[model samples]
Target: MFVRIVKLSFDPTKIDNFLSNFENQKNSIRNFKGCRLLELYRDKANTNVFFTYSYWDSEQDLENYRNSDLFKGIWANTKIYFNDKPLAWSVDKVVSLL
Candidate 1:
């Protein structure tokens, strides 16, 4: 499995707008082909900072989603609220306790 994590820092005053956008598009993202899991996390110390964790079947699957219009629209809307450039990582499991 391919694990993708994206860290986003939003404008503190526009966090609500970002959340609204996520609410509108998250289901489509989760249901996208080859998507295995999707989750969102908030930084306890900074509400304007958030992270998205997702699992995909492969790198190509993730790439396909990134190229789709769904991602285009979502990213277009989301990036408008950014306070900083987003950080993303794609990794594979080296080990799992479970």
Candidate 2:
């Protein structure tokens, strides 16, 4: 599986907007081609920070999503909420502790 992790820091005032957007669009995102799983995480110490963890059948699948109009519209709406540049990583599972 291909794993993608993205760290996002949002302006405190805009957190609600971001969360609302996520809640609204999450189902569509999870149902996208090649998506196996989709999850959202929040930082215990930083209320304005969040992370997205997703699993795909392959890296190409993730890329396909990233290049889609769905992503473009979402990203356009999302980037405006950021307080800092987002960080992302694409990785392979080394082992499953779970």
Pick the lDDT winner: 2
lDDT of 1 by residue, 1-98 (tens): 98999999999999999999999998999999999999999999998999999999999999999999999999999999999999999989788795
RMSD to the hidden true structure, all candidates: 1.0, 0.7
- Clashes counted in candidate 1 amount to 0
At residue 3, what lDDT does model 2 achieve? 93
Cα miss at 28, model 2 (Å)?
A: 0.4
For residues 4-97, write the lDDT of model 2, one tens digit per residue.
Answer: 9999999999999999999999999999999999999999999999999999999889999999999999999999999999999999988888
TM-score of each: 0.95, 0.97
Inter-residue clash pairs, candidate 1 = none
Relative to the unseen true structure, what is the Cα RMSD of model 2? 0.7
Please identify model 2 stretches exceeding 4 Å from their true place: none
Question: What is the lDDT, from 0 to 100, of the residue 60 in candidate 1?
Answer: 93
